[model samples]
Target: MNALSDPEPQRSIDVAAVSALDEPNRRRLYDYVSGRGGPATRDEASDALQIPRQTAAFHLDKLADVGLLDVEFERRTGRSGPGAGRPAKLYRRAERDIRVNLPERSYELAGQLLAQAVDEAESSGESPRTVLARLASQLGHDIGHQTGGSDRQLLETLERCGYEPRVEADDIALVNCPFHKLARTHRQLVCGMNLHLVDGLVTAAECPQRHARLDPRDGYCCVRIGTTTD
Candidate 1:
């Protein structure tokens, strides 16, 4: 479709957030603080982990910086007199979720689109599959039109969607399935939807020479782009 938007932002941010756990002390501090229902003070975390107070503070701050932890300021002691010191810094698990899967899966996106399609179909008295296929195809068509309908452009769009396309002589094989886990149990449903989605992409990209075909393999995705016969 139109020039594909880069997927680098979310992928990079997720990787960074996940990598924060690689630090032993930071991971420990995160676990200790998050395991509790209430936010943890630096002193509580340091005491629990046997790490120095300063070290715990540093790691907790780092975790907060990366969005893996939320920071708040509160007085641990009930006393609120003038003699009371500044509010103690507290740490808790951030509400944000961070997933860093290699090869990147986006089953959630597919599920949302499918659910929306079903709802629309039900309300409009249209076939659910037909509505879904039309929506998926229109997405591809719009992108193709935006990207100038080039093979390279189409592949770029697929790559951004995490298809991991591998170009062969006259075909393209997807090395990664964005709906891998979902496809395991819902194989027929997901694969059929994927096939139609890709076909829509190809058709809209104006690549009449090639079409998406279901060629399920042991380790690869269920869809492949093959040269059209006649």
Candidate 2:
């Protein structure tokens, strides 16, 4: 088995950062700063965009406050000590990536797991599918362990992972597949991985009464967590 680090926590779109760009002046300033290839000063932005310096400053500060732009202070004149004037505040594109999706999807997470499986298989001379199942299982185990080993935790974990789990009596049915598109195109591969992942989750969570199995149905995830009978 190959060692893998836990996936980075998912980040939802920052509404405030996005809303700040709704203003025309602020949006223009953001575009200018992002395209400038370097930090921009208020004077530079005002002159380039033909906006008033005060207007540019207000919008720039707004952008920075909302995290749409990063702020830095530097003496552009290359001077030192008290003899030099106060460092000018400059604006640049923020390093954070922002994305908005309706209903929320985690294609990136699926992609990362697939890529890791391929890399590990190539290096270890193992079957790609085999490696993928192992990787997915390990990820599920990690998620279960982190969320605490309980039935409630398992459901919460699935929900957080975009599974949209629905409870029916003692069984849980998933209404959404985070890797929907991928699963549609590569049903067997993706579904197999999904089963192993969910199975691992159930095992790690110590859900003795739950059993994960392939119960493919229309408009539902391929894997279903059903109640186990003694």
Candidate 3:
């Protein structure tokens, strides 16, 4: 179907799947990974979170094992453009987000963040929609960089973050996030805010002009690879 046509309703994430992530270390890991994109090594996680490298690696790999993270060998590239013997393995945000349900109040915190992001975007002297679009573009750009420039990789990252989008048209896509459950239950604006963020990601990478079309009234917010298509 064409993108302008009505979209199919989306379903909620499985509750049991979320419940599997109830442990403390795993919870902390999720927050850290989601806040900023990184495929942190054990030493980095330990240093940042104040945990031991062994403990951090254990937790990180646990998350990775559960399909919440992507792990692979990464040869450390020296900034000096020198050489290295063997590359270190790196773990990054997985393409498919786990949609782990955090504490309920996260909605409140996210609500505040949304208002702040929107205000900041607007204060830059752009229309709210334009600001949102830029936000999306930047987000997508960042994700692309994190995932090595694969739009499929980028889309998977968005899915993990709660926004599920399938191809619609060459220049259009449909997005459905599982977090709408939280929004419906808590009257939280975060879901909408998140939508805007994802929209911003898409706008940043896919459609600079279309990003300008984003607005908050509806609340809530992709790209293709190698096709020269929109």
111-177 per-residue lDDT for model 3 (tens digits): 4554656798767776555554445446546653444234565557655554444443432232333
Clashes of each: 6, 0, 12
Q: Residues 10-47, candidate 2: write the lDDT tens digits.
A: 23236777777789988888877764536899999999
Query: Where does candidate 3 stray beyond 4 Å?
Result: 1-20, 79-83, 97-230
List the lowest-lDDT window of 10 residues for candidate 2: 1-10
Q: State TM-scores per candidate.
A: 0.55, 0.55, 0.38
Instruction: Decide which is better by TM-score, 1 or 2.
Output: 2
The global C-alpha lDDT for each of the candidates, from Candidate 1 onward, is 0.78, 0.81, 0.51
**Superior candidate under lDDT, 1 versus 2:** 2
* The candidate that achieves the highest lDDT relative to the unseen native structure: 2
Once all C-alphas are superposed, what RMSD does model 2 give against the true structure? 18.2
lDDT accuracy of residue 60 in candidate 1: 90
Ranking by TM-score: 2, 1, 3
Please identify which of the two predictions, 1 or 3, would achieve the higher TM-score against the true structure.
1
**Residue-wise lDDT of candidate 1 within 63-153, one digit each (tens)?**
8888878888887677797988889888876655466644467867788879989999999999888887777777666655654356788
Q: How close is candidate 3 to the true structure, as a TM-score?
A: 0.38
